[model samples]
Target: MIFRTPPRAAILAIAFLLGAGFFATGAAPPSASAGARLALGGVALAFSVVALRCARMRIVASDACLKLYGPLFNQAIRWADIRTNVAAESGVDARTFGVRTPVIVLTSDRKVKAQPVSSYSFSGGTDTPADRIAGQLEALRQSS
Candidate 1:
C-alpha cells in the first residue's frame, strides 16, 4: 500500500505561521511574543515539509527481503534480520505513526547493535497507516 502526506496539515501549518506573525507583530505586548511566534512559526513550517514528504510510505515484501520507505526514512530488511512485528500507538500531533506505532525491531543471532527509526506524525492518519505498514512487513516476514 502507498501512504502520502496530508495536504491539510501543511496548509494549516502555513496559515497558522502567517497569522501568528501578523498578529504577534501588530501587538506591542512584548518582544517575547514576536520571538515566540517566530519560533513556533518556524517549527510549523519545518514540520509541514516533513509531513508532506513522510506522507508517502511504500512497503514491498518478497521471499528474499522486505522493503519499506516512507517520507522520513527508508530501510531494506532481510528476512533473517527482522524480528516479530510490534504494534504501537502514534499520532501526527505526537510525531508518531497513526494511533498505534508500528515498528519492526531488527535482531541477529550474534551480538549486534540496533536503532529505532523514528516515524513521522503529520496527520490523524499517521498511526493507523503505520500499523498497516507493520502488518505488511509481518506478512512478508511470514511468507519468507
Candidate 2:
C-alpha cells in the first residue's frame, strides 16, 4: 500500500507567486539585467521543484520493505531490518511553523531515520496520520 501526504496549497501558491514576482519585476527596464533575471528565475525554479517534491512525498509499504519518499531524502528499510517504529512530534521549527508536527521515526540496525508525516493542522495534507503509519509499520514488521 502507498500512503501520501496531502497537497499543500500554500506552498504551491508561494512558489507560483515567487515565479510571477520574478517575471513581473524582470520585465521592468531598470531590473532587466540578464544576470539578475537569471538568478531570480533560478531561485523560483528551485522553489517550485521543492514544493512539487514535498507535495508528492509518500510512503510505500510492501511485504518485504518500506520506502519513504521525501523532497530531500529517500530511504528503504527491509522488514527484517526494522527494530522499531515510533511516532512523535518533530522539534524542527521550520517545518512546524511554531506548531508541533508529527514524525515517524524508524529505527534500524544501523541508524534512525525520522520522516515528517503530518502537519499540526488539516492544512498540512497528511492523508494518513503519523501514529497510523507507525501502526502499519509495526504490523509489517511483525508479519515479516
Candidate 3:
C-alpha cells in the first residue's frame, strides 16, 4: 500500500502562492524596476518548489518493510522493528490552529515515532483515515 500527500492540499497552496506573486509582479507601479518585479517572481518560484517538495512526500508498505519518502530523504523500517502502529494526534499544527492531524505512530523498543512522510487530513473525519491505516498496518505487523 502507498499513502501520499493529498492533491487538494498541494494544489491549493501552490496556486494561492503563485497567484499572489503574479498579481504583485503584474501590478507593480510603473516606477518599479524590472529587478523588483523579478525578485517577487523569484520568491514565488521558491515557494512553489517547497510546496512541490512537500506534495511529493509518501510512504510505501510492503511485506518486509515500510519505506518513507520525504523532500530530502528516504528511509526504510523493517516490519520486525516496528513493535506496533496506532493512530495519534500530531501536535505540529495543534497549538496554533487547534487542528491536530491524525497520523500513524510506530513504536519500537528504541523509539516511538510518527510516520513523517504521510498524514491524512480530509479523508472523512479527522481520525478516521489515520485509524484505518494504522489498523491495517498493525494487522500487517501481526501477520508477518
Best by lDDT: 3
Least well predicted 10-residue stretch by lDDT in candidate 2:
97-106
- Number of the top TM-score candidate: 2
- Expressed as tens digits, the lDDT of each residue in 1-144 for candidate 1 is 333224433444466555555544543446466567777656655655555444444455666766665545666677798777765455344344333455666785332111122334455554544455566656766777
Cα miss at 53, model 3 (Å)? Answer: 2.4
lDDT of 2 by residue, 1-144 (tens): 886545343454466666656654554467477787777677767666766666667778888788777777788867776776655444444564422233334453454543435444434433335556666666767777
Which is better, 2 or 3, measured by TM-score?
A: 2
lDDT of 1 at 47: 59
Instruction: Give the backbone clash total of model 3.
Output: 0
Residue pairs clashing in model 2 are 6-125
Worst 10 residues of 1 by lDDT: 109-118
Q: Which stretches of candidate 1 lie over 4 Å from their true place?
A: 1-52, 89-98, 109-129
Q: How many angstroms is residue 139 displaced in model 1 relative to the true structure, after the best TM-score fit?
A: 2.6
List candidate 3 stretches off by more than 4 Å. Answer: 5-46, 92-108, 115-126
lDDT of 3 at 76: 84
Q: After superposition, how far is residue 134 of candidate 2 from its true place, in Å?
A: 1.2
- Each prediction's TM-score against the native? 0.44, 0.67, 0.58
Say what the RMSD of model 2 is: 4.6
